[model samples]
Target: MASHRRIRSRSTKPSPAVGFTTAALAGVTLLSGQSASAAPGEPSPSIEEVQKKVDDLYRQAGSATQEYNKAKEAATEQRREVDTLLDQAATRADRLNESRRALGTFAAAQYRTGAVAPTAALMFAESPQAYFDQTRLMDRMTDQQQQAVADYEAQRAEAAEQRAEAGERLEELSASQEALRTSKQNVQAKLAEARSLLSRLTAEEKARLEAIEREKAEEARRKAEEKARAEAERAEAERQAAQKAEAACAPETARETAQPPAQDADPGSGTADGGHAAKADKVIDFARAQIGKPYVWGATGPSSYDCSGLTQAAWKAAGVDLPRTTWDQVEVGTRVATQDLLPGDLVFFYDDISHVGIYIGEGMMIHAPKPGANVREESVYSMPIHGSVRPA
Candidate 1:
């Protein structure tokens, strides 16, 4: 999530990114000349239609937010890689310089003493083996001198390789940063456009719109709960059937030993007991702690968040590194069917796969909604689901 810092208004600057113009949003078309406080007539657009339009705008903004998150993640990784390469290159260069200085001192010593060494000549010779026999150099050089020659050659090669690697990493870092900046601007523009559309509504219309949202959330919750209950019953029945089958096949003493411990249900924890259960619990804890924070387009923080920013941060807290966008996030972990979704699973939304939320069981999720909204828990079904994934 971005910080709670004030977003610079686009009032003075014209943005080509937004599809809607300010003039086009001057009035609420859904009202159809009806008073803001009164019910709409036959010609007025239904409240449902208006709500759908608003949802679409929010979805568009979410897509841009995902792009921003992806670029941010890439840039961060590139920067770290570049830094490491630079450090390695520096170390290699120092070693190369030391080797050169050592070789120089050896040469100068030979010059002062006027010692014409056969091995030194052989090292510079076109064919070392052929010259070794010609000059009888093989028996002349000590082990330390041979090792020094080898070390010097290795250091020089390492320095050259490190310099090339550093150059490549630096170039990649530059491209990543440029993409990050462009994605940030795109998210801001989409958010600005969404805010513009919502801002055109009267206070009464806004209240009514919120009411519709709540109703949908409640409806989704109900359906999710019903599905959960049915699944539990089916699981329990299967478990009993399996136990009975095992008992029938086993001897009486073995049957008693084969029984597994009974499991307890904790409603608050969304994940089932498995390999990732503990990590998932930590992720859920971090996500819950972020509730009510403001949604800032590029912010990932203790204070505010964008959608992917919040998810990335939460999973990070759990000691798992997740990619920054819903698109990439969806590609991670095992693909889970909608019917098998559990707590700690990341659920994505929309045809473009723009939005995401952390499932907290019972078909509910915690997500950082668009601008003017806060990080909060809502039904996973509140938006059209693209897919789900569980990050270990």
Candidate 2:
């Protein structure tokens, strides 16, 4: 589970590196009397449309929350059951301690050769009745110890299963919230865009229009809340899926038994003389040549470039077409551990996947950070490091 880790808001400020702007939305609006939303005497806030969207949001939200609660309850019950079982096991251990004391005393008495008043034979007995008593004691003690062991093992297994289930539920919660936020943003953006250029309509028409807007705003907010809940559920589902995928995406490793040890390997250090570093050096050099260029999200040219766009253009000069997104770019090659990072490696950031930069050796990297931001050489640590990725 994420615990108290606040969900990283994908939202950002306008200056670039990575951010969002609903400003684009204000420029878009279907305003007062500009167009008939429907037939004459028709109010666009029809019961049908509002009901449908509202119902969908409610249903999705309810289902997701319900599932989360169920999973949570199941996990709680499992935890309680495990604790109970462990307590019981501990009680049995106390019994085991008593048994050990009895056995220890019995052993010492039996082994002594002294003329003791109460000998092992006397205390434990030698007749058929006493012999039977000793045999039964051995059997009863062994059974009790075994039962405790079995109970503890079962409880441990149940506890582990419960934990996994809880984790899966939590992941669903995160994903659902993410989706909800996105959907709400979209709706809000669309609604805001509608406000501009609505002055063309008459007063009565405007009032009618305002009423519709109020109704829509309320409905949108409600749906957004619903979306939030749904997002929580979906997040968990996505996390479970990712976990499963990562598990299945195992890397191949050589297996050997009793093989001679190989020579010690060094901490890979920084850039090397040849191979990837050589090609990477050329790309870096070429990118540096374009240092005076402006940052453009999707632009790729002599004039401007977005972070990924710049990397793509540079790589193109070096004869490769790396995938565009930072997430995809990470898979371009084997991942370089943070400690072993080198020049030409690509470091990425999160939130809309808006920032990307190419490593320039040391702790330095080059990137066209964000729109209105100039292309420059910046430290990888200057911004948050989601992680560093290498091209394949």
Highest-scoring model, lDDT: 1
TM-score of 1: 0.66
What lDDT would each prediction earn against the true structure? 0.70, 0.53
| Leading candidate by TM-score | 1
lDDT of 1 at 128: 66
Clashing pairs in 1: 1-299, 1-300, 1-305, 1-306, 2-299, 2-300, 270-343
lDDT of 1 by residue, 1-392 (tens): 01111122223332111111221233335323433432456465555666666667667767777777777777788889888888888888888888777777666654653465666766766896777565543344334456667789999888888888878888888887888788777766765554555655677766667666556655776676676565565566767887888778788657557687556577456343454667777888999999989877778887999888899999999888987777888899888887877668899888999888898765567888666667887767677888899887
